[model samples]
Target: MDVAASPTSGPATPAGPDSAWMLREAEQFIELFYGEGNGQGGPAARMAEIRAEVAGTGTYTHTVDELAFGARVAWRNSNRCIGRLYWRSLWVRDRRDISDAAGIGTESVKHLVEAGGGGRIRPTITVFAPDRPDAPGPHIHNEQLIRYAGYPQPDGTVLGDPRNVGVTELALRRGWRGAGTRFDVLPLVIETARDGIELFELPPEAVLEVELSHPRYPWFAGLGLRWHAVPVISAMNLEIGGIRYPAAPFNGWYMGTEIGARNLGDTDRYDLLPVVAAKMALDTSSNATLWRDRALVELNVAVLHSFDRAGVKITDHHTESNRFITHLEREEEAGRTCPTDWSWIVPPVSGSATLVFHRYYDDADLRPNYLRRECPVEGGPDRT
Candidate 1:
C-alpha cells in the first residue's frame, strides 16, 4: 500500500495558530471562493466579518458553502492524485458538530457505506470538527478507514498486510482482537481530547470486499485473494484556510494498478508475484525470462477483471492517465495551475506506457491541501 502511514503515537494535539496568520489565510480563501463565482456575497464583506470574528475569538468559522468549496478545492490542489477531473462532483458530508470518539467512529462507518454506494463507489469526504483555538480536533489512528490486520508470527513472518503491523499492535494493546484471518479488518482507533482513545469495529456490511479471480485462470480463485472496494484515507489532516480538520476521512475509487502493481505485488507488501509466476509456470531460472513482469501484468489483469465482473467501480491506469491529461487541459483553459507531482502522477506499473510518464510537472506545495499528520513522538513510528 503506497498510502500515507497510519499515526502510531497518541492523539494529535496540534497547537493553536496565530490570529494574524489565520485572518490572512481566511482572506486568501475567501477571495478564491468569490473569484471562482461560488461565494454567496462579496469577498470584502466576508473578509470584514472574518476579521471581526478572529479579533474576538482568535478564529473564524466557515459557512457550509465555504466548507464544501474549500474541500473540493483541496482535492483539486492535491498534486499526487490522478483523479482530479471530477473534483467538483465530490460529496461533502458536513459533520463538524460531532467531535466525540463514538460519534466519529459511527460516522466513519457511515462514510464507508455511503461512499461505497454498494459497489458503485462515489468520491466523498466526511469533514469532522476542525481544531479550534482552545481545543484540537479528533484524530483517527489508522491510515485508512478500512485496512487488513497484520499478525507477526514467532517465525519472523507476517500473516496479513505488513503495512498495518504498527496499528495492529496498537489495537491489540487496546484490548481489541481480530478473527485471526489474513484479511480481517482492523478496528478504528479514534482519539479525541474529551473522550480519550476508543476502539470501534467496523460492521461487516459496511465493508464491501471483492474476491479476486482472473478472467481466464480458473486456478486464480484457489489462491483466495481479495481486497476492499473503497480506499478511505483517514490519517491526513485537511487544512482549509488555516483550519485543520485532523479526522476528515475522504475516498476516491481505486485504480487497478494501485492494488495489483503496488499493494499485492510489491516485495515489502504481499509480494505475490512469485506465487503468481509459479502458478503460470514461467521460466524463473534467469532474469532474462522476465517472469516478474509477466506475472505483474497478469495480476493487474485479474484485478481489473474481478472488479469489473463484480460491478465495482474501478479504472485502469491507461484510462486514468488519459483522463488526467484531459484534466490538465481543462485546468489550463480555466487559467489555473494544476500542480502535479510527476513521481506520483505516473502509474506504478508500465510507467513509460502511460501518458503521464512523459511529462514534467510542478511539484509545488499548495495550500488548502491534505497534509501528512505528524507523529507525536521524537523519532516517529517504529517500522521494525
Candidate 2:
C-alpha cells in the first residue's frame, strides 16, 4: 500500500529555456549521440524528427538506447566522480512512464534491492518521468534515499545525523515520525502538484546496512556506528538533450573516505574523532600530537575493514585513485578530454598521497549532466 494518495497530475514544468534554446541543446546532444555511433538512425534524420516534435509539442522523447547511452556518458562526463572507470557498467532503470508517487516509491525500493545486489553493489540509476512543457516531473525530497533522520534536541544538539536535520524536520511536518533512534532511516518524501507531498517508508529488505567495526580493536563495534550499503542520490536533476528528469536517483559503491573521513569524522556531522581518540587513549592536548589525524586514520581503517568483512563491495581511496588515473589515460587514448575537478577527485583523508591530488584537469561545464535541482519544499535546506 502507498503511504499517501498518488497525485493524478504533476506540477507545471518549472520555467526554463524557450523553444529555441531547447532545439539548440537538442541538436547538439543528438549530434553527439549520433557522432558517437550510438544512434540507430542518421543524425540529420533524427534532428529533423526532433525539430518537428519540438515545433508541435515543445519536446521530443529519447529512444531507450539513446537514454541509456546518454546516462552512461553523463557519468563519463561527471567531473567529481572517482569511480567513472566503470561508468559504462552503470545499470539504467528507465521508468519514464511512472509519474505517480506510489509507483516511484515502489520503483525506488526495487532500485535499492537490485542495486545493493546483496553486498555486491552495482553502480545504478533509476530515471523517472521528465519535466515537460505541460507538466513537471515528481521530486524526491531526501538527498539520498537512505539518510538517517536528525532530531533536533532542546540542548542544541542533533540526536541523529546533523546533516539531515532539515529533511528530518520536513518529515515531521508531514506527520511522519521516525523510531527516534540515531540510525532511523528517514521516510522517502515524494512531491507533485496534484498530491502536494507524500511520504513513503522504505522497507527493511530494501535498506541493506553495514555495521562498523575494527579488525584490530573490538571496541569499535561498541560505538554503534553503521551506514547504509547503497547511497542512492535522489535529489539531482538529470538533463539530456534539453529534457529534464528531475527525479532521477543514482548510486555508486561507497569509497572508504566518504564514510570515515567525511561523514563520520567531520566536525559538523557525526564528529566521531574525539570519541575514537578517547577509545584509543590518545592525548587530545595539542595540535602537534596529531591525535585527530591518528584517530581519522583508524576510523578510515575501520570503515574499509568493516565493509570488506561484511562481504560488501567497497573501494579504498588509494585503489580508486589509481583507477581514476587509468580512466583518465583511457579517455585520452580515445581522443577525449577527461574533465575532472581535482579537489573532488582527490580523496579527503590522504590528499597528498593519492595520485589524483597532483594533477590538474579540464573542468568544463558539459551538457547532458546531473544538475542540482531547485528545492520544492520552502525553507528546507538543500541536503546535496
Best by lDDT: 1
Task: Give the lowest summed-lDDT range of ten residues in model 2.
Answer: 1-10
lDDT of 2 by residue, 1-384 (tens): 000000111122247768888888788888889888886768899988888998999888999988998888877877777888887887999999999999999999999999999999988889999888888889998878888888889999889889888878888998998899889999999997668689999999999999999999999999999988887888777788888888888888888888888779988789899999999999999989999999999999998899899999888889988998999999999998787877677778888998988878887767677766556543232212
Model 1 lDDT per residue over 214-237, tens place: 989999999999999988888788
User: What lDDT does candidate 2 reach at residue 285?
Assistant: 97
Segments of candidate 1 deviating more than 4 angstroms: 1-14, 376-384
TM-score of each: 0.94, 0.94
* Superposition TM-score, candidate 2 onto the true structure: 0.94
Error of 2 at 349 (Å): 1.0
> Which portions of model 2 show Cα errors greater than 4 Å?
1-14, 376-384
Residue 66's lDDT within candidate 2 is: 84
Q: Evaluate residue 10 in candidate 2 and report its C-alpha lDDT on the 0 to 100 scale.
A: 19
